[model samples]
Target chain A: MIAAVLLSLWIGSSTSSIAELRHALFSPDERVSDIAIREIRWPRTVTALAAGAALGMAGTLIQGHTRNPIAEPGLLGINQGAALAIVSVAVFSGPLQPWPQALLALGGALAASLIVFGIGRVDGRGASPITLVLVGAAVTALCAGVVSAIVLLSEAALETLRFWQVGSVVQGYDSFLALWPLLLAGTGLAMANARGLNALTLGEDSARALGITAPRARGIGLAAIVMLSGLAVTLAGPIAFLGLLVPHVARRIFGADYRWVIPGSAVCGALLLVVADVLGRMLARPGELPVGVVVAMLGAPFFIYVARRRKPVTV
Target chain B: MSARRTAPTALLLFLATLAVLCLHLSIGGTPIPLPDVVGSLLGISPDPRTELAIMEFRLPRSLAALCAGVGFGVAGALTQTVARNPLASPDILGVTNGAALGAVALLALTSQVQGLPMFLHAYGLPIAATLGGLLVSALVFSLVWHSSLESNRLVLVGLGMSGLCAALTSWMLTLGDVYNAQQALTWMAGTVNGVSWADLAIAPLVIAIGVALAAALRNQREVLALDSDTSRALGMDLGRDRIIMLGLATALAVAATVIAGPLAFVALASGHASRLIARSTVPPVAHSALVGAIFVLLADLAAARLFSVVLPAGVATAVIGAPYLIYLVIRQTRVRSA
Candidate 1:
C-alpha cells in the first residue's frame, strides 16, 4: 500500500522523478514537481487510501453479516442514498463545504439503510438475501430517479453531479480532515464486531447458541457498514463493486476469520484504490479518470464473475 | 383470461391512452386549448405558434411516448413470460442500462471525437442503443444459462450486469463536456423533453413492426409460458421459440429506449398492470402495450405539468413503479413463505 501510494505520487499528468519525491519529502523545496507532489498528488493519495480502506472494511462487515457473496454497499442503496443527499443539497443550495456534505451523506446513507432494513425486515428477522437485494435495487432506482430529476431540471445541479456522481478523488484533503475520525470510529466498530461476525457467519441460531446476541451483532455490523460506506461515498463519490469485491479477496487470503478478514479487506482495499488511482492518472493523461470509474472498470467484471459462479437458486 | 373477455378491457385501455394523449398534447408550459390541438392534428392551422407547438413539439413527443410505451410494454411482457418471473424486465435485467450506455457512449464520442460524419450523428444513436441492449441481454442470458435459466438467477445476474453497465455509462458521461453530459444525463433519466420529429424518425416504425410481430406470435407466447417439457411435448421447439421471443423483446425495448431514455418501470408495471386490469393469467401483449402507452403519457404529463420544474417521465415512472415493485416483492415473499 505504501509503495502504491508512492507510485501514485510519482505519476500524474506531469511525470516526476524519484529524486523529486525525495526532495519533496526531505528537502521540502518549492520546485514544480515538489509542489505538485505536495499540493495535488499527496492529498489525492490520502483520500484514496482512507476512502478505499473504509469501503473495503464496510464490504467485509456487510458480507460477513449477510453471508451473501454478492452484497455490497452500492448494491444495497447506501451509496445512492448518500449521492441523493449530496446532490439535493447542491441543487437546493450551492455546493456545500466538504464537512457538511460528508455529514449529510452519512445521514442520507443511514436513512436509506434503515428504510431498506425496515421494509425488508419480516417481523423480527430480516428478509431473505435476494428479497433484500431486490428491495435495495428498488430503493436505488427510486433515489436515482429523484437525483437525476433534480440534476436534469437544473443545469447547475447537472454540472455539480456530473463530476461528483462519477466518484472522483480529485477534491483533496478537506474531506479527509472531516472524514478520518469517523472512518476510525467505523473501523473500530468493525474490528470489535469481528468475533460476533464470525459467530453470525455460522448462522443466526448457531450464533445465539454461541452466546452472541444475533440482532445486536447484526445491528452493530450494519452500523459499521453504513458509517464506513457513507464516509467513503462522501469522500470518493460512491465507487461501485469495491465493497463487494474486497471482502471476497480478503476471505481468500485471510480465511473466514473476521479478525483477519476485516484488517485484510482494509489493507487490500487501500492497495487496490491506490493502485487504481495511479492507473487512472496514467490512463487519461493530463485530465485523469476518476478513481471511482477506474475501480468500476476493474471491479465490475469481478462482480459478474462472482454472480456467474454462485449456484443458481431454484425458484 | 380469455381473449373474448379481454376485448373490453383492451378497448377501455386504448380509450384511456387516447384521452391521456390528448391531455398530453393539449397542456404544456404554453397551454393550447383542446380545440386548437384537435384542429392542428386535423391539418388545420391554428395559427403558426400553436401549429409549431402541436405539429413540431407536442406531436412528436406524444407519439414518442406512445410508441416507446408500447415497445416497453410488449418487451416487459415477453421477458416476464420467457423467464417465468414477473419481476424480470428490461430495466431490472440491465437491458435499459445497456441501451443507455450505448446511447451515452455515442453522444459522448460525437462530442469528443470532433467532426464525425453527419450520418453517424443522425442514425448512430438508435443503432448503438439497440446493439448495446442486445449485447447486455446476451451476456445476462449466457451467464445464467446452465441447462435452463432459473428466474431468480437470471434477475440476480442481470442486476450484476446492470451495475457494470451503469459504471461504464457514468464513465462515458465523464468523457464528454458539461453540455453533452447534461444532455446525456437528461436522456438517461428517460425524458422525451425537446424531442424533435427527426429524433423520433425510426422509433415509431420499429415499434409498430415489433408490436405487429408480437401480436402475430401470440400463440407462441402462450406456449412458451408452459414448462419446457410441456412446451416441447406440444410440438414446440422451446429453444428456438425462446430465443426468437427474447430477441424480439430486446428489439422492442431497444427501440423504445432509443425514443425516450430507458423509461423505468413502464415495461415492468405495464405487464402487471395489464394483467391485473384484464384479469388475465398471463400479461396480454396487446393490452400491455396499450397500458404502457397510457403509463408513459400519464407519466410525461405528470413530469412536465405537475412539477414546478419539468422532470423526466422516467422519474415519475420510477417514483411510482418502485413502490409497486416493493409491494409485489413483499406480496411474493409472503405468499412463498406461507
Candidate 2:
C-alpha cells in the first residue's frame, strides 16, 4: 500500500523524477515538483486510500449481515441512490459545496439501501439474494431514468457534473479533506461492528441464540455501508465493483472471521483503488481515465467469475 | 387458463397498437390535430409542411419505435419462455449491453483508427453490435450450463456480464472528444428522437428476420417452459432448441440496441404485459410483440409530450416497468404459494 502511494506520486500527466519525489517528501515546499507532488498527487493518493478502505469495509458489512454472496453496494442500489441525491442537488441548486454534497450523498445512500432492504423484505419470496440483486437492478434503472430526465431538464447542471458524473478524483484535495470527518466516523463505526457481523453470519436464529441482536447489528452495519459508500462517491465519483469484489477477495485471503475480514478488506480495497487510479493515469496518458471506470473494467470480469463458480451460491 | 387464448384478444391488442401508433404520429411538442395527421397520411393535405413533418420526421421516428418495440417484445417473450423466468429479457441477460458495448467500441475505434475503410465504417457498428450480443448470449448460456440449466444462475451471470459490458462502454465513451461523448450519451439514454431513415435502415430488416425466426420457433415455445427432462422425453433437443431461441433473442435485442441505445425494460415488461392483457397462462409471443410496440410507442409519445424537456423513451418505460417488476415478484410469488 505504501509502495502504491509512492508509485501514484511518481506518475502524472507531467513526468517527475524519483529524486524530485524524495525531495518533495522531505523538503516540503522547495520546488514546483514538491508542490505538484504534495498539493496534487499526495492528496489524491490519501483520498483514494481512505475511500477504498471505506468501500471495502462497507461491502464486508453488507455481505456478512445479508449473508448473500452477491450482496454488494453497487449491486444493491446504494451507488445509484447516492448518485440520484447528488444529481438532484446539483440540478436543483447550482454547484455544490463539497461538504454538504458528501452529507447528502450519505443520506441518499442510506435511503436507497433501506428501500432495497425493505423491498426484499416485503414478502418471504423477495428476501432471497436473487430478489435483492434484481430489485437493485430495477431501482438502479429507475434512478437512471430520473437522472436522465433531470439531465434533459438542465444543460448547465450537466456542465457542472459531466466530468464528475464519470467518477474521477481529479478535483484534488478540497473535497477529499472535507470528506475526512465522515470517513473517520464511518470507519470507526464499521470496526466496532466487526464482532457483531460475524455473529449475524451464523443466521438470524443462531445469532439471536448467541446473544446478538440481529436487527440492531444489521442496522448499524448498514449505516456503516451508507456512510462509507456515500463518502467514497463524494470523494471519488461513483466507483462501482470496488465494494462488490473487494470484500470477497478479502475473505479469500483472510478467511470468514469478520475481525480479520474487515481490516483485510480495508487494506485490499485501498490497495485496489490506489493501484487503479495510478493505472488509469498511465493507460490513457495525458488524458487520464477515471478510477471508477477502471475499477468497472476489472471488477466486471471478477463478478462473472464468481457467478460461474460451482459452489452453490447462498442468499 | 388455456381456454382464454383466443383470436379476439390478440386482434384487439394489434388494433390498439395501431391506434397508439396513429396517436403517436399525431401528437408531439407541437400537437398536430388528428384531422391534419389523417389528411397527411391519406395524402389529401394541402399543406406541404404538415406532410413533410408527417412523412420525414414523425413517420420515421414512429416506425423506428414500432420496429424496435416489436423486436424487443418478441425477444423478451422468447427469452422468458426459454429461461422459464419472467425476468429473462435482453437487458437483464447481458445481450443488450453486449450490443451497446460493440457499437460504442466501434465508435471509439473509428475515432482512433483514422482513414478507416468506407465500407467498414458504414456497416461496422451494426454488424459488430449484433455479433457482440450473440457472443455474450452464448457466453452467458455456457456459463450457466452446469449439471442442469438454472434460471437464477443464468440471470446472475448475465447481470454480471451486463455490468461489465456497460462499464466497458462507459470507459469507451470517456476516451473520445466532447461531441462523440454527447452523441453516445444521448444514444445510451435510448431515444428515437433523431433517428433518420438511414440510421434505421438495417434494424427493420434484422427485426423482420428475427420475427420470422421467432414465428418458426412458436411450436417449441410451449414446450420450452416445461422441465428439461420432460422436454427431452418429448423428443425435444433441449440444447439445440435453447441455442436457436437464444440466437433469435440476441438478434432481436441487437436490432433494437443498434438503432436506438439499449432501451431498458421494454423487452422484460412486454412479454409479461401481453400475458396480462391476453389473460394467457402461456407467454403470448404474438401479443407480446404487439404489446411491446404499443408500450414503446406510448412511452415515446409520453416522453416527448409529458415533459418540457425531451426525455428518452427509456425513462417513461421505467416509470411503468420498474413498478411492474416489483408487482411481478409479489404477484407471481403469491400465485406460486396459493
Best-fitting candidate, scored by lDDT: 1
The model with the greatest DockQ is 2
lDDT of 1 at A171: 57
Clashing pairs in 1: none
The TM-score values for the models, in the order shown, are: 0.94, 0.95
Stretches of model 1 off by over 4 angstroms after superposition:
A89-93, A123-125, A152-172, A310-315, B44-49, B108-118, B176-182
Separate DockQ for every predicted complex: 0.55, 0.63
* Local error of candidate 2 at residue B171 (angstroms): 1.3
lDDT of 1 by residue, A1-315 (tens): 678888988898888888998899789877888889888888888888888899999988877776677778877888789878878888878767777888888998998888887777753455677787888889988998888778767666676666565444455367777678898899999999999988887777899999999879878888899999898888788677888889888888998788998999999998998898888777766677777778887887887777676563211
Candidate 1 positional error at A164, Å:
5.0
True contacts kept of each: 0.60, 0.64
| DockQ-derived CAPRI band for the predicted complex in model 1 | medium
Off by over 4 Å in 2: A163-172, A313-315, B1-4, B177-182, B332-338
Clash number for each model: 0, 0
Pairing residues by index, what is the TM-score of model 1? 0.94
